[model samples]
Each structure stands twice: as structure tokens, then as C-alpha cells.
Target: MDTTTHVAQTERRRTSPPAGSAGPSAGADPRRGPKRLSPRMRKLTLLIHVIAAVSWLGLDVGLLTLSVTGRISDDPETIRAAYVAMDVFGDVLLIPVALFTLVTGVLLGMGTRWGLLRYHWVLTKLVLTLVAFTATVAALRPGLEQAARDALRTPPEVGAAASDVLVAPCVALALYTFMTVLSVYKPWGMTRFARERLGRPGAHGAARGK
Candidate 1:
């Protein structure tokens, strides 16, 4: 071939995308994201996440009940017992619930059409769960320890300002309840990321054609 023809061919090869990437959207884009999970794996993850969430809520209810009982009961022994139980449950049950729920939900999101940032509701839930987890670690567990220690003191009486031992659990219950409702309703519209992908020209139509 002539020098001119050779130069033109090289330019075309360099400019054109590699084979199998000529469509509207290519996998090379970071935003294109990862592939979804199989239906079986998705269902399994959802089941685990649901169980962890419900268990967390139930444990919080137990803590709340103990708190109320300790607050109303005049007996120091009852109060001490309640605080100790709270400590044990918090350590043994609540921590695992929080960690498992967070991990499973993240996996579920990544492995489904609901990319973590794709929907407003999903994003909100992720934020709330993270916040709840942070509170569990930074404040809730430590506060439980403090309350347990205070209850074990010489007098064995609940402290005058021991309301937190009662209040934190109640707040956690409410927070978890809200999260559950969000999961059910999923009311919010698509997030910016989802809109961009599922928007104009119907690029995602094939993948989401169900």
C-alpha cells in the first residue's frame, strides 16, 4: 500500500474502539459498574439481611424492656440485673446483628440492579445503617458498659442520670423501624446515577427488560 493509505489505516485502527465495545455504553466505563448476582444468590442475601435486621430490632426491644423495668422497679437488685443483661445482650447479640446486616445489605445492593447509589431509598438506607452502626460502636456499646459498671458500684442503685441506658435502646428501635419501612415502601425515585443510566435513549432497556 501507499504511504498515505497505510497512515489512514493506522489512524482508523487507533481511533476505533476494540471489538465488542461499539454499543452506546461500554464496560470500560467505571460508572457502568459490576454485573448482578444470580437470582438464587440475590434471594439468599436478601434473606440473610432481613433476618439480621429483624434480629437487631428484636434485641433492641429486649433492651428497651429491661430499661423500662429497671427504671420502674425500686429494688436495687432488679436494677443491677437489668443493666448486666443489657451489657451481655449488647455484646453478644447486637454487635453481630449490626455487622451482619451491614455486610449483607452491601453485598445485596452490589449484586442486584440496585447499585448502591442508584436509588434514593437505597442510598438513604445505606446511610442510615452506617450511622446506626457507628452509633452502636462509638456510643451505644460504651454507654452500656458505663451503665453496667455504674450498676455494679457499691450502692448498686441506678444512677440519677442513667436515663441513657433506657433512652438509647428506644432510639435505636425507632431508627431500625424507620429503616424497615423504607425497605418496604421504597418510595423515593431514582437517584442521579440511576437516572443517567436508565434515562435517554433506553440504553439499559435490554438488561432491565424483565
Candidate 2:
């Protein structure tokens, strides 16, 4: 009886999984794993992001020009045309563009190896983007509307505002490139990520590796 028990226990031990082996289909869990990004999907996402950003800049230019010009003919018809363009552009171009950029940006940040919390540039852009979004929705739109209203009624010199408008894209483009640099170079000044996973390594480790 004792010999039989020992043999049975040895057989069971032999049949058991090795250390760190996840049984039959090791590391095959549906959860806690990565979903692969198809190349077409990536290209489409990039197209949408770039196009939408360009549209936002272009649409702003149109509206800015119309609002700034004092001699745009205050005939109800002309004003209606201006407002119509503004409304159409805002409803169609602006909202969708901004939404796509924000959504895609978030996905690109989190769904990749970087996981959003790792990189310094992505981290900085994350902060800057919040401010930019707030400014666009909470401040820029209102400011533009008030400026338009004032432009319609009073003959004020808003060359300063218009000048900013012309330069805004350049500033934004520069800042965006700066964000990209932060993503690429990842020069560290702030507190580290509680690990040495800055820039791409953080992303890579989070996505790949054991």
C-alpha cells in the first residue's frame, strides 16, 4: 500500500506543469495581452489625425479672416453668409477634427507600448493638450465670438488679434514638434517614471518583453 501511494504521487508530480509554465497554452490569456494593430488601420488613423489637424488650422484661418475684416458688408445677407460658413465649418470640420485628434491621440498614446504615463514628451503634450482643448472650447470660441461681435459693431483695430491668429499655427506647429522631440529624445528633468522606462523603452517594455 505504501509503495502504490508513492508511485501514484510521483506520477501526479510528473504530470503537473513546470514552474512558470501556464499549462497547455502558455501565455494565451485573452486578457492582459496586446491586440495587434493592422497596418491599414494605422495608416487610416494617421491620415485622419493629420487631415483633421490641417482642417482645424485652415478653418480657423477662414473664420478669422471674415471676422477681422470690418468692411465685409454688414448686409444681413453677407453677415448670414459669414455666420453660415462659421456654423458649417464649426459643426462639420471643427468638431469632428478635434474629436478625431483627441480620440486617436489618446489611443495612440495608451494602446501602444508607451502606455501614456511613461514618456516625457507624451506626458508634456498630454498636459499641453488639456490646456489647448480648454482654450479652444472654453476660451478661444468665446473670444472669437466676442471679437466677431465687437468687430461687427465697433471699428476697433484688432490687427493684434489677427496677427496672433496668423502666428498661432506656427506656434502650435513648433510646440507640436517640441512634443515630438520629447517623445523621441525624452530628455529627463522631471521625476522619473519610478523606473528607467522613459521614451520608447517604456513603451516597448509595456507592450512587449516579459
Candidate 3:
């Protein structure tokens, strides 16, 4: 008679999450992180960027329209209204839009493998975006605010012309247009650093990706 042998298979088991996980299961894949962004959050970020860009563009267009409609510095009341409108657009919307656009565009760009600083086009876009952002803060916003404050002192009709009102708006619109073109054409060639770093896995990913 042959002796029969029995084997016991021990299954490996996972430990429960430490109370400190804060809520997520400890066994969850750590690499995936918290899945910090939901479908909703991603959509929201994209929407915010779109809205901000449109707002910036629309503000420029609105100012131009006012000029075309003969609303600049000619009438006292119109000038005052323009002042209020610009301030509202600036304080309430434009600044926020700009900040959100800049931040979100950066985050989105970095998050994707497309890479923000690697390719020439992305680099150029980044430079232009920063330039546009700085110009808005330093030149554009100040000019509008000054126009408003000056409106307080200067006659509604003082030193005013359609050209005067349209000038800043047109300039801002041009920047916006340039930005849009860069986005569409992305004409930047390639960054030397990026080419050198190309073989590296996710340098851009390291910069932007979690």
C-alpha cells in the first residue's frame, strides 16, 4: 500500500487599511493615487479654460463694439458707464479668467503626455501665454483702470476718440488672436533640451504628471 500525502495550500491575504488611510482602502493601487480628478472635475477644468478664454475675447470685442457704436468719451454718461463696465469686467471677471486660464492650461498641458516644455510649439505657447498674462496685468489692466479714474477727472468727452477706446481693445484682441493661432498652428519647432531629453520617460510627465 502506498502512503498518500495531503497538502495544505495557504492563501495569501491582504491586511485591512490602517485607520489613517483617511478613507480610501489601503489595498487600493497606490500608483493610481486617489483618482483625484473625477470625470466631472476634468470637464470642469476644460470648461473653465474655455469660458475664461471666451471672456477675455468677449471683453475685448465688447469694448470695440462700444467704440463702433459711438459710445466712447463722447457722452459723459457713456464714459462713466464704460468705466464701470471695464472695472466690473476686470475685477469681477477678467482677472479671474486669466488666472484660471493660465493655471488650468498649464495643469492640463502637463498632465498629458503631449508635453508642455518639450516641443518648440508648446514652449512658444507657454512663453506667449506668460507674456499675454503679464501684459494684461501690467499694461492692459492698468490702462483700463486709468481710463476709468481719468474719466472721473476728464470730461466724459475729454481726450476721447473712438480710436482711443479701440486702441487697447484692438491690441488685446491681437494678443488673443495670436494666442489662438499658436494654439492651432503650434508653429514652434522643437526645444533643444527637449530633443536631448526625448529618450527619457516622461520628463514632461515628471514635471506635470503626478
Candidate 4:
């Protein structure tokens, strides 16, 4: 080949991308960072989600403390007070905060690029939150109310009889703590759905092109 033709062919080889590769950027893990929420309403919804989640966790901590106190205390008045406080906290604070947190989390996931079933960590957090909330309402709340009633009887018995209340809060506390950690770290990679969506020719490439 002539010198000019050889140089042109070399240039073409240099510029051409390798076959079957989406390039370096596409190889990155989809769970690396969150997409920015630009809109005011999305930001507000995320803020509410954070607030409600933190409040729910704090309330679980309070309930755990009350459970320990009720379990250990021999004095009927102390036991009664602890169980009553648990009942009141559950009705007034825990239930409301848990429901709000769940709803806001769903909204945030739906409205943002971090979709409901996209990231593995997000999906795990959603499931854990749902299970925790369901258990709190169906099992823990009723158990607390019953424990409070039993504690108010002539001879209060909140020791082993109310063990469910104690154990339930401990489980909830652990679950909530794990969920919080998931929010902060987001350790796992993307789900299959996320990969499929992000790997589309126009969708992901269009953003990078801009």
C-alpha cells in the first residue's frame, strides 16, 4: 500500500472502537451513586422520608428501652408505667411514623431514577421496611396494649407474659438499624432490571452524549 493509504488505514484502526463493548463508562457498577433530585417536590419528599425514618428508628429505641425496663422491674407501678408508655408510644408515635416513612420511601423511589426495583439495596430496604411495619402494626401494637392491660391488673405480670413485646421491639430495632445502614452505604449492586434499563442504546447513551 502507498504511504498515504497506510497512514489512513492506521488512523481508522486507532479510532475504531473494539467490537461488542459499550466502552469504559458502561462497565461501571450501576449502584455507585444516587442520581440527583433536582425538583423541589422530589427534594421535599426525600426530606420527609428521611425525617420519618429517623423518627421511626428513635421510637423503636424508646420502645426497646421500655421493654427492658418492664421486664426487669419487680415493682408493679414501674412495670405498669413502662407498659402503658409503650402502648401510648406505639399508638401515637410509632404507627404514624412507620406508615409515613414507608409511604414517603415508596414515593421517593417511584419519582426518582433510583427506581422501586432497580438497585438491590433499595429493593432489600423496601422489603425490610414493609415487613417491619407490618409486624409493628399487626403484632407489636396489639401485644403492647395487652401487656399494658395486664400490667394494670391487681397483680401485674409483665415479666414473661409480655415477652413478645420485648422480643418484638428488639427485632424491629435491629431491622430498622440495618435499613438505615442500607440507606447510608447502599452496598449491593444493581438489580437485573436496572442493568437492562441502563444498558439500552438510546437511554443511557443519550445522557452520556449530552
Per-residue lDDT over 1-210 for candidate 1, one digit per residue giving the tens place of the 0 to 100 score: 999999999999998888976544643544445668888998898899999998988888998898888778878899889989999998899889999999999999899766799878889999999999998988888888888888888777576435876888878888888888888898765666676765544535644675
- Sequence-dependent TM-score of model 2: 0.55
Per-model TM-score versus the true fold: 0.77, 0.55, 0.65, 0.75
Tens-place lDDT per residue, model 4, 1-210, is 899999999999898778877655667555433545559989899889989988988887888898899888989899899999999998898889999999999988877777789888989999998999898888888898899999999889765548998888788878888887898898765676776766653544554466
- How many clashing residue pairs are found in candidate 3? 0
Show the colliding residue pairs in model 3: none
- Candidate 4 CA-lDDT value: 0.83
- Residue 8 in candidate 1, Cα distance off native in Å: 14
What order do you get sorting by TM-score, best first? 1, 4, 3, 2
Candidate achieving higher lDDT, 1 or 4: 4
Worst 10 residues of 1 by lDDT: 23-32
Off by over 4 Å in 3: 1-43, 67-73, 160-165, 199-210
Worst 10 residues of 2 by lDDT: 189-198
Candidate 3 C-alpha lDDT tens digits along 1-210? 333322222221234444556444445532222334566876787788788788878977876775454353467777677665765676677677777778887765665444676567767667777887887787767666666666566565434433455577787788778878877886745455755554544445565555
User: What ranges in model 1 sit over 4 Å off?
Assistant: 1-35, 197-210
> Local error of candidate 2 at 21, Å?
8.1
- The list of candidate 2 runs beyond 4 A from truth reads 1-36, 60-92, 154-174, 180-191, 194-210
lDDT of each: 0.82, 0.56, 0.64, 0.83
Best by TM-score: 1
Ranking by lDDT: 4, 1, 3, 2
